[model samples]
Target: MQLVDFFTLLFMLMGVVSAVLVAFHPNVLYAAVALVFSLLSVAGLYGVLGADFLAAVQLIIYVGGIIVVILFAIMMSENIYRARFRDAAGKFVIPTAVAALLIAGFLKLFHDAKLETRAGLNAIPTTEQMGRALVGPYALVFQYVAIVLLAGLIGAVVVARPHHGNPESEAEKK
Candidate 1:
């Protein structure tokens, strides 16, 4: 097999194994670490597929931003570290059945679909094209997304700030 194919398989395996670990691990901290590995492997798969922009976004948004936030939240909550989570008996049966059904349906769809294969298509750099598109035709949409993100950030800050307006809280502080 080619190097790219080998890397693709490796990333696929890593992603699957890590995802399983994330789902089944008893320790929440270990599960969180496994989640990181799973996300990173997905980013690697995106890179292997020549979707450089998607890979970067996956690394930046999911791995960097979301994971960091998750880790921070986990670390900040003292009760989570002391808590032992246990699943009820037979809890996995329904979800497992649903997942199996979905997998079977997807497999049937793939088997029935007539997919067109294009040959000799080069992996072009999408960063420049995306940048131009963001600033050119899709500028408004891009600006809207930025504005929404900024608003969310401001809202989060507002919500997280200490509410010192209550007389009870002020008395407790004194």
Candidate 2:
């Protein structure tokens, strides 16, 4: 097998393992860290696909920015030790059924399509073109994303802040 194929397999494995850990890990902090690993693997996959800008953006925006915020949110929460991370058996039933249906549908589609293996996959560097599209035509959409992320950050901070009138704890005295 080629070196790129080997690395692709490795990164796919890493991403899947870490994603599973993110779902199944009992410790919230550990799950957050696992999510970071998963995101890094996705960035690696982007790099393997020759999307340099996408890889950089995935690393910077997701792994660097969002994961830090998630970590902070996890750490700052008061009942970290008391939190239950395991899901009940009944909770997984519907989701599992839905996932099975989706997988079966996808399989049927792929089987029916009988897609031919196309030779000479042209690798287009989309960095400059994507940048121009984002700034030129899709500028409104870009601004909306920024606004939503900012709002989410603000919401996180607001939710994490201790309530003033709650007489339950000694933390918020003001």
Using lDDT as the measure, the top candidate is 2
Off by over 4 Å in 1: 79-85, 97-121, 162-164, 168-174
lDDT per residue for candidate 2 within 15-118, as digits (tens), equals 99999999888888889999999999999988777777999999999988999999899899998866757636368879889989998999999999966431
Cα deviation at 75, candidate 1, in Å, is: 2.5
Query: Candidate 2, which ten residues in sequence have the lowest lDDT sum?
Result: 114-123
- TM-score of predicted model 1? 0.77
TM-score result, candidate 2 = 0.69
Model 1 per-residue lDDT tens digits across residues 1-174: 888879989999999999999878876777889999999999998787777999999999998899998889888878675544454446878978999999999999999998543224356777898899999999999999999999999999999766788787677778
Identify the runs in model 2 with alpha carbons over 4 angstroms from their true place.
87-89, 102-120, 137-174
